[model samples]
Target: MKTELVQCFVWGVPVYRQRFSLVASRPATERFYRLIRSAMAHAEQLRDPFTGDLECDETTFGGARKGKRGWGAAGKVIVFGIVKRNGVVKAQPIPAHDRASIMQVIQARSREGSLYYTDDWQAYATLKLRGDHVVIRKEKGRPVGRDHINGIEGFWSYAKNWLYPYRGVPRKHFHLYLGEICYRFNHRDRDIEPMLISLLKRLTVDDVDLN
Candidate 1:
């Protein structure tokens, strides 16, 4: 396996990576990375449901961050996210930020009976029946420890930072990019090279959803 090839991508854009670019054509390199992104890019790659102290939150992608704070933010795409403290994070773009829409992701990505933490939002009120829900009031100010939904919030920051380097991703391909973020965040603590290589090898054209 070409470890450096994988390293070039994991580190950052390969076009600027002179060592790899010198040996491989820029077009080839670009195509290779796109293939990688497509191959490993699917939220369904997460086979297991998350349990434990899960933090749920939402963030907007693309468009200028103007008007309405969250869901109704003009021209922005809404992505619902849930992160298990000290564990994996799952994120998916949703058509609406309503209770029904957000709950669908929560139910599918996480197991029942897990404790949930979030900021004051009526959308999450439905989580109470599913499990214990702790609502953190921002007016009261954030206290120390797991009292806040920092895990998922931190994920939002990390994802945005990762996406920033790409300049802009078209709405059609955004989910694949988001899936790549989730894959990286989920396996962050491990020796990622072997795992990524294995995942790259295991996946075929079928894993990517072009439509």
Candidate 2:
């Protein structure tokens, strides 16, 4: 059961209760998801603040509804993300894509004077004062020059793709799901099985024996 759960997580498969019901109870399957979420949250918390060349972007999450799409689309959760070139990426749900909300994430998760690469979003205009901000003007379907948000944009794609199987994530539990994606992205090059085993051993209740 444990091995199957680990495989599901490593492969980005949704561990539905019905899928694991033969070997594990419904509560146990839910517990496994919680454990995965906990491990991911811990890993994300331990990540170093992003420095140097960085890409920042905002994405909206939620199903299609009656209204606008992208940017300030109503009823969708706003998520702000930052990725250091060839390094770690982090994302969190925000209340809005306004200047204050965006800058708050930048100040907390990034280092001072780190070069920020982003689209020509007005919210990012103030970032120029704190660091070297490169605005990538969209040309046709791509950004001009070497300036591109592909790194962070890739993360959004990776996250959404991984999440699509779940159909829809509850708004309250969205952050935990996001954390899992961030963990997967950050550890993309590492052998995830051993890392996951270590985290599980440290976090799971099974490790503690009752007298």
> Candidate 2: lDDT of 111?
91
What is residue 66's positional error in candidate 1, in angstroms? 7.2
**Which parts of model 1 are misplaced by more than 4 Å?**
1-4, 14-27, 63-70, 140-146
Residue 25 in model 1: lDDT: 72
Q: What does candidate 2's lDDT look like per residue over 15-60, in tens digits?
A: 5735734467766776677677767776786677788999999989
What is the Cα-based lDDT of residue 13 in candidate 2?
64
Alpha-carbon runs more than 4 Å astray in model 2: 17-21, 72-74, 204-211
Winning model by TM-score: 2
Candidate 1 to truth, TM: 0.84
What RMSD does model 1 have? 3.1
TM-score of each prediction: 0.84, 0.88
